[model samples]
Target chain A: MMYLFFLTALFMGWSLGANDAANVFGAAVGTKMISFRSAALVSSVCVIAGAVLLGEGSSEGLNSLGNIDSLLAASIVLLSAGITVMLMTRLGLPVSTSQAIIGAIVASNLFFHEPLHLESVSKIALTWVYSPLLAFLISFALYAAIRWIINHMRIHLLMIDHYNRILLFIAGAAGAFALGANNIANVVGLFIFPFEKAQVTLLPFFPRLSTQLFFLGSLAIGAGIITFSKRVMITMGNSLFELYAVSAFVVVISSALVLLLFSSQSLSQFLQHRGLPSFPLIPVSQSQSSVGAVLGIAAARKGWHSIRRGLLLKIAAGWVATPLGAALITYVSFSFLSLFIDL
Target chain B: MKLFTGKNKMLMSNIDSFLQLIGDSSTYFHKALESYLSSDENTFTEYLKKVSVIEHEADELLKKVKHDLYAFMLIPDTRADVFRFINDLDNIIDSSKQLLVQLSIQRPLFSPSLSDGIISLVTVNCESMKALIETASVFFRQPSLVENRALAVIRCEEKVDAIGERIEREIFSLESSYSLSEKMQLSQFNRQICSLSDLAEDIARDLIIFALKRMV
Candidate 1:
């Protein structure tokens, strides 16, 4: 009964993986530049590597924001976020796991009478704006460079196809790695206190207990990719945007760079030690970053007129609604849970 | 990177050979037309047979390239445009086959004055095809250079059109001994020969637009 609570986190991880895996490999699979099988395999393997290795920094940031010390409390927080994602997606509303988890964490902190870390909250909110903007800028610069190179090279059409396939695979792998590293925190970071005590030893081998939980979380994400991501990936390829192989390559690379910017401790440390401003280690949404990267590409290819202004406004609205929805749901759920069990 | 597998390399070589076959077919078309004008039946038949054989080989190569492109290897993004122009080259080969076969079937006796004009028209068509093939070849390797090569084709097409008109007028205004039906037959043959250059010119114009995409 006690351990059953972690299953919610596992569910959260699964959903996160299923949805975000598309963000990484969707364009490649959709464009027929990469096969679904190759995309899934590379995403799974690299996701696990990222979760186990680079997942630490962002999880620490989530803990600073708020960590529920009790298993029941942690489960409630994660489940609330999971339910919010599922409900919003079902309603065809734009949703983000990062916003949901942050909202749930803040709600849980309020429920437990813990002081909210405003600094961490502010840092996270800032990244919500910065992540996509960063992705857009990165995509713009990368697309320009790639376009120039392709024109100047004058390679045979077959040779260009060969290079696109090769580059798309490598970019997909990097995107997957960044996905796992950046997003594992959203899956299990709230359960840090419980995970710290309850060791994860049986599954993916790792040195630290959090690393093991990340391994477990990443497996669920990998499972999500294999089981449910095929349609999502193909749909992304076919109708969502119809990205060319080079465009897909650029999107994935930009998203990965944005995620890495938020998650890499060494990069942050290097920036801080040199007195340069560093992005806070926060789990920004990969899906949002991808949308931003796409917008950047559209803007670069055409101009601002090319960007769908309606979609931009809708996503901005979702940013506000997701967190408030998760917080409201978590607060109400806490009330319901308290009636049945002591907090 | 090794760049291409053995299978892909073979496919690429197949595409190259197909373009070469079109060029070869153009040469044969010229030879066949020249021999027919000279009334050398034996040599005309020989060149016609060569064109037919090259047409068959080029078709086989086209089928393989089409298969490979559709099978998800070559027919990706901008490459689709490249293949479309490449596909147009096959039409050139087919035109050569049609013209040679028609000549072989009719074997009309060309007037002595008309033979020179007909030969001049065929020469222009040949030059136009040469430039068309060059435009396609450059499109694959150096698309930036395709504009000049394609323009060369258009220029040849202009020469072909002028010669074709002069020949048609000459046939119609020939000596009173020439029968009306005989003049009509020669005019029809002249028009068919000019049509090949027209096809080349159309492909070259489209290639310019496609090659512009490749540049920026």
Candidate 2:
């Protein structure tokens, strides 16, 4: 019976992988610099490593949002978020799974009369707004610096081409690792409370049951990447303004840096140790960060004229609509499920 | 396998071969024009055939360049720009072939008075083409020098334009026994040859734009 509830979390993990993997290596695959098979292999390994090793940081904030003691309610929330993401994806809209999950959790809390963690919720909300803005600023500065260095170095065009290909691979790997570290929380963070003491070692070599669950979630993400990310990668690679190899490199790296900044617990602690303000470890949207990076580069190059305003407006609308739609869906679905099941 | 491994060297070699073929085609055009002026029918016919063959070879090289460009992952930054540049350069070869063919079909006689201006126009246009080729080659080898080399092409084009206009004026003022239709044919020939230089200048402008993009 517990296994049945776990499937919803796996479904959510799969949806996150299908949609967010493109944010990591879309341009490289789209430009035909890296084959789709090679990208999938690298992304799978890195995402798993990241989730197993460093996925805990942002979950602290996520867990604080609302703790649902009931497994049935948690499953409903996950299912509602997954279904909302799937619906939005079919509608050709770019919605963040992280945002959808948060909204679903909030709605579930309200429905059950659970105490809302207002302070943590507000902190997570602030990071969501800051994440994209920071990504844009970092990308703008990084691209300008790269452009300066290219002009100063007087590198041959062929040599620059070779260098960009290598750099793109490195950046793609970094982005994948960052995606796993930051977004694994969105996939499995909500269930951690109920399963906190439930430990089952699947393999003799493994540590505990929680690690196993995280591994399973990461595997689902890997499956999503292998089976479903190709079309989204192509759209991201070609539909956006014609990204030169250099610009593509800058965008990927800057977005990865933003994710790492928000998700790295060690970095946050180090800042606190130094008497500096620590960054909130929130599970921000990788899709938003990637789009922000592109917009930053575009704005740096040619201001508003270079950006696709209509496409961006549609994305903005999707961002606002995703969470609200997921919350409403979760409310309705949970009420319907309560009628049939003893919650 | 060889094409995949050393793509930089292969693209450079292909570009070199394409430039060599274009130069050969331009030379054949000059020889054909000179033979026509000297009234050597057999030599003119030989040069026309040579120009046609060289143009065909150049076209083949262009096709290979395009095929390799699409097949292998070469320079991603400038690949599209380079592809468009090659297409533009291909036009010069086509114009050279068309000019030779026109001379062969019409067989327009040039008065001795107009001969010097006609040869000068062709000479200037060929020189412009040669400079443009050099600039394009330099663009691939050393992008920093591309802007400087492109300036030479611009200067050569100015000379071609000036000489072409003078030749047109000379054709209209001819006091020899020529019919109105013959004069019109001569004027048309002058325009066609001059059009080659204009094409070169247009290509040079594109090269400059490409170079500026690299600089940025």
DockQ of each: 0.36, 0.28
Q: Model 1 over residues B1-216: C-alpha lDDT tens digits?
A: 222354456667888898789788988888888888888989999999999999889888888888777775453556567678778888888878987898788877788889999888888888888888888888877878989999899999989889999999999999988899988888888998898898899899999898776553
Top candidate on TM-score is 1
Residue A33, model 2: Cα distance from true site in angstroms: 2.5
Task: Tell me the whole-model lDDT of each prediction, alpha carbons only.
Answer: 0.83, 0.81
Candidate 2 CA-lDDT value = 0.81
What residue pairs are clashing in model 2? none
Give the TM-score of chain A, superposed on the true chain A, for all candidates in the order listed: 0.94, 0.92
| TM-score for candidate 2 | 0.85
Q: lDDT per residue, candidate 2, A1-343, as tens digits?
A: 7677878888777877787888777877877777888898999899898787778887777888878777788888888888887788788776778888888999999999889988887887777678877889999999888877776676656656666777878888999888888888888787777776454344456575556667888898999999999999878776442447688888788888988898899999999999998889878888788778888888888876888887678667776788888999999998887788777
The digit string of per-residue lDDT tens for model 2 on B1-216 reads 221366666766787889888788888888889889989999999998998888888888898888877776566557888889888888888888888888889899899878888888888878988898988876765667887888888898888888888988888888768888999999999999888888888888889888877654
lDDT of 1 by residue, A190-213 (tens): 766776766545444556778878
Q: What's the CA error at residue A335 for candidate 2, in Å? A: 3.9
The C-alpha RMSD of each candidate to the native structure, in angstroms, is 2.6, 3.9
User: Where does model 2 sit among the CAPRI classes?
Assistant: acceptable
